[model samples]
Target: MRAFVLLCLLLPAFGQYEEMWGDKDYLWDTPGFTTTKPKHKACLYEKESCGCCLMKKQTHRMEAFFNLTHREMKKDLMLTKMYIDDMRASRSAFSFALDKNDSTECLGPFSDDAGIVFRHEFLNLGNNYNPMTGIFVAPRAGVYSFSYTISSDMKRAACAHLQVNGEIVSEIHGQDGQDSVDSDSVVKAIKLKAEDRVDVILPKGCIICSDKKFSNTFTGFLLYATV
Candidate 1:
């Protein structure tokens, strides 16, 4: 498979090999030299054998092959470097939870829709997710995986909406009047382009519970890059 790929890449160049490198005899004497030419094996197969040829065509072919191989290797190296640089610039991922270093509490039963800011960060390698506004902006085009958990007061609705660019993609809801902890979760994989916004929305009259144990959480990662 590897050889096939290289052959595909070099076929065009190989077709013009003789034009790029002229057919010159390697064993020929200089024009000014009068020395007697040494005898070399005159085999039937000029190319397939190691026998020294009268014109030494194999020697010239070997030299031209080395030159072409070097050029192809250099071109491949440059392309690999370009791809690595692009990947470094485009990487993005983040994981965060609500209310780190704080006791049990309920956040937001706000009058208007609000973004949930997760204060506890487990991993924010790319720093794409903003803790202040609870928003993640994609760095490049790719499929992304996101998982969020909602824990809220038993008396208030435990709900949250996964919004991408102001449009809701998924939701988790727990109705009021529960005797135990009201918790819900949603996991989704979505395709996004560069600069797309993602966030969890806490609507009016909704709350999320959090504590030192981190009952509510939000996480996202770049699943795979795309064109």
Candidate 2:
């Protein structure tokens, strides 16, 4: 009986020791239990969230860059268009001359004649010069160079004036007495506004002679556009 009681006491002590240091006491080693630290899990979640935010920031930055580039490109395109338009406006030019060959059929010697319109087109670029009206209408505000020539028949003297907007700028006169042909030419530069008129005028009693060789000629060209 005594030996039986001693064995029972030893068995209870062994059971107590097992309960204090059993597998169940170690939660990490238990089935279905996580070994990850809470701080470590939180750090991983934060890192993943930050990565997503970084990607979004990069996407926004790229979009902004492209938008800026597109705006700049549009501005440049507008500027290019403006430049092309300016170049076209600056290309105004014209030249014309009389084609009358017979002195009897020549234009002029009229009462208050505004000058004979050349009625001929040698180089009417931009069509600014009107052959019928004998006038050049400035296409834009710019400096222009005008040149004209007048020829007189033998024993006859002819005089003409280059006029801008009805104001005289220069004049040409030719006189010959010995049965010889005489010619006079004049060149002048003037600043003009758009629609300003330029023409040659034959004062009363003035006569000009020309032949198929276009002895009486008028020419003008845009030096540079001011507008």
Candidate 3:
């Protein structure tokens, strides 16, 4: 009688500490984990009950350990991949001039604002700038540097505006009535988001004097990436 009493007491204690699904326990106070109260541990009625319970306890412990370790490893791998992808992000820089040859071209005194489509490519590292559109669409979110030079014929006005997303950011203007060309430039650093558009605009009444010497030009580069 004493041995049976001890087994009953010890089995309940073992279940409370070792089992994932326990009766009337803090983890399973609701009916979701269990449907009925346990009748008996069956150690006395069945020959293999105690052994099976012990084996189940060991198996549960191993499965829990393995699941936790696997989850931690997967989280670590995802973070490492994000870091590597950021390191390999593309670098952007482009420089262009108004004319490809020494011959002068009177590039505009339009009725409306005109975009300067560059004719010469000095450097284009990432192909982010489109010569056809006279626009530089940022590939990565970051601070960037933009510069422009406007050189105009003696009788015409030399002027250009730097615009981001159709909003004017800066301008370069110089004009001379004498028989000589005039020029001006402005450099600016601004933060931008990916796919943001940047361009040079020539006002309706201004003109740019262009030649092989890159007298009229626009340039830009990525200072750093923010995203």
| Candidate with best lDDT | 1
Q: Write the per-residue lDDT of candidate 1 for residues 8-57, one digit (tens) a residue.
A: 45645455455654434432343553334333532322343323442233
Best-to-worst order by lDDT is 1, 3, 2
- What are the per-residue Cα lDDT tens digits for candidate 3 across 126-193? 89999989999999899999998888765766888999999999987665565477788899999999
Which candidate would rank higher by lDDT, 1 or 3? 1
Candidate 1 accuracy as lDDT: 0.78
Name the lDDT value of residue 100 in candidate 2: 51
**All models: lDDT?**
0.78, 0.72, 0.77
User: What local lDDT does model 3 show for residue 91?
Assistant: 80
Task: Give the clash count for model 1.
Answer: 1
Across residues 153-205, which tens digit of lDDT does each residue of candidate 2 receive?
Answer: 64566779999889988977665465566678898999999999999998777
Best by TM-score: 1
- TM-score to true structure, per model: 0.74, 0.72, 0.62
